[model samples]
Target: MKFFNEESDFFGLTKLKERFYSSDHDGLSEADREYINRIKGQNPFGIISMFIGGVSFAFGPIYVAFPIITIIFCFLTCGTFDREKEDNPWTFIIGFCLALIGLFMYLRGVVHELIV
Candidate 1:
């Protein structure tokens, strides 16, 4: 049976197939597809890591949690940048800077006990 039509419903598979094969597909190379999948796979892990890192940093020792969380955030920001480089680099830079700032503040607080 014909799959392409205005109202032909093959459990939405036809629509999905249409979207998958549309002109948008032309913009995606094999490497891009692989990278997209890799980023997608890493997203959940990164989110969990970020959450855990934040909790540890907020509640645990600054010396231990600050570096660990900073590293996690750095990795997450790198992954995010890789996924959206074509769209904007500023976001990645901002995220990286924030992570660094957080790390620095934590270190300063632990060392000098100065609120400033």
Candidate 2:
């Protein structure tokens, strides 16, 4: 009935002793540990946003709004990350760019039709 096990890495692939008590992990303070645990407990919104953005690319010009919306979601999700010192922001940036490309392609088709 133990809620917090010192022997458990909270289900992370590495053992708790190896992950939290090892030399490489020794630099983590209590606040850092709490922050990591809190982040691990949250839903993965960035991945979900990327997935939705990727799926939106398939519907084409008729559903132009979907990609646009996905781009906004990507930006919003990306903004939550610590961009100055981390590589994770690139993932969201790439997703946002894909969504933007899809949106532009969709608009290009409409513009061509109107011009012709």
Backbone collision count in every prediction? 0, 0
Instruction: Indicate the TM-score of model 2.
Output: 0.50
The segments of candidate 2 whose C-alpha lies over 4 angstroms from its true place after superposition are 1-43, 83-87, 110-116
Residue-level lDDT tens digits of model 2 in 1-116: 13223212244312422333334547889998767644532224456666776666555355788888887666544544433323365556566766776688787874224323
lDDT of predicted model 1: 0.45
Looking at model 1, the pairs that clash are none
Where is model 1 poorest over a 10-residue stretch in terms of lDDT? Answer: 1-10
What TM-scores do the predictions have? 0.32, 0.50
lDDT (0-100) at residue 82 of candidate 1?
28
The candidate scoring highest on TM-score is 2
lDDT of 1 by residue, 27-102 (tens): 7889987676444222332344455555444533355555456555445334332243234344434444444555
